[model samples]
Target: MTDTTRPQDPDSRCGFVAIVGRPNVGKSTLMNHILGQKLSITSRKPQTTRHQVLGIKTIGPVQAVYVDTPGMHEEEPRAINRYMNKAATSALKGVDVVVFVLDQLAWTTADELVLEKLSSLKCPVILAINKVDKIEKRETLLPHLDMLSRKRDFAEMIPVSALRQTNLLPLEECVGRFLPQSVHFYPDDQITDRSERFMASEMVREKITRQLGAELPYSVAVEIEEFKHDGKTLHVSAVILVEREGQKKIIIGDKGDRLRSIGQDARIDMERMFDNKVMLRLWVKVKRGWADSERALKSLGMNDF
Candidate 1:
């Protein structure tokens, strides 16, 4: 734990800024682009981020602690869905600024739900229209920006593409202007608040989510059973949980080929993240209907907050 209360630079500006949006809206991608590091896991699947991951960035004397939250959605049927909603909404409180990321042209009821949540908050909201790279017509933005302007009074609005690294400097500068004058809460070099074990586990899950078919990724979860560091190499043992026996087979593949691919890809990602050698071991286990069980979700640290 970093000493947040220690004596900080007097002229430093530090505050919490949250990234919130509907599922698969590129909120995680935006944070990673701004920080210049991949702290949050990214996949095409909705609700891939089930927890709040913090990334700290220092530019000159300003430190923006960006909290990448789970996508706030209306699907509350399962225990995991409800937990993700709670985790996402909870990030709104005590935040100095809110960066509401929205799809370039896809606005649905889920986006309305997020807008409603921001409507009542006291903090300033910076509306980020993400994925502008997909916009083929350059002249269409004027009217779209006009329509969004009438929706709500935003502190600042910018069209940015997180994946292509477009207009991120203006977005970061807009966020920095609203931060309260205070001392830096974290050291300049700290990129994220999460530990290696958690990131290693998420990296494995990201590969699984991206590699396997649609339904199986939603039913799967990764748990780091053990993580140890020997000065030279980091050892990680992860268990991949599934809802049934059939899903387990799919992840393991024929002759365990799929599992080996996931392990190889995850090991490479971890090695790059840790800047050292990583030995990763994976096992697929069946935790029948675990996603639907509240006790099971809590046991795996999904609802740890």
Candidate 2:
């Protein structure tokens, strides 16, 4: 939204590009790689990205405001899942270009759900075949790519390895071609639309997701209590909310070891991103089944926080 209201660069090329896909299709990874920074948190877990993370990449004459949306899929309409779905689908509207990212060879009903949503879009949609590095046989992708291409008349069809930094230039250039000529919306140095505090909360949540058991991630959310910098060192205090006390125990670990690891890992990332020493204090508090309650979700700052 910040990028949308900025002054236009009359002659420069700038446009909003929404990156949409099913879970674990590397939407966040692609955004981070393209921006050359980790603005969106990523993990092996599906639906790791809960918000619409915007990363702005201003390269010379082309400034691409990349909207990295949460994975689109069918859900039970739980409060949290509905929130994530809303974030993803809402991002698709009012964008100049749409990047429909898909796994290299794996297509599923979830991907079809995302495609169904794109049916009404008025912008040019680019089909990006992600995770191509996993495909050892390049020839196998030809038939699949052709099949995908026939599904819709995509503005461009590309195969890329988001994690390995492969074949992104052509993708960016091709996207830039669809963008209307306009003035730069953001400063050349600004890479993302989110604040440092927001990224910090996501980093903390990411560590918990990466280190915890498979079932724990869906039951967790991060709340940033305090984020401040006293010139030399940045101090951040955050709360890790879990759905149940047992889940809280898992996050805290034996003798609080798991909690310590989450804090340590998050601190390291905070230091790297903030370019300053970080003192991160994390507390685990049980807010039972908050993900399923719309009231709890609202209180947890799920909307525009």
Q: Which has the greatest TM-score?
A: 1
Worst 10 residues of 2 by lDDT: 1-10
Model 2 lDDT tens row, 1-305? 23342445455788899999998999999999898888999999999999998999987778899999999989755889999999899998799999999998988999999999999988999999999999999999999988898888888889999999899989998898899888777877788878898899999999988987485758798888899989899999999998888898899999999899999999999999999999999999988779999889888777853
Model 1: lDDT to the true structure: 0.90
User: Candidate 2 has what TM-score?
Assistant: 0.95
Instruction: Mark the regions of model 1 whose C-alpha exceeds 4 Å error after superposition.
Output: 1-10, 213-217
Which residue pairs come into collision in candidate 2?
Answer: 8-183, 9-182, 9-183, 9-184, 10-183
Candidate 1 on 1-305: residue-level lDDT in tens? 45453346565788999999999999999999999989999999888898999999988778899999999998788888898999999998899999999999766999999999888898899999999999999788878888888889999889999999999999999999999888787877788878888999899999998887485747789999989998999989999999889898899999999999999999999999998899889999988889899999988888756
Give the TM-score of each candidate.
Answer: 0.96, 0.95
Q: What is the lDDT of candidate 2?
A: 0.89
Could you tell me which residue pairs clash in candidate 1?
A: none
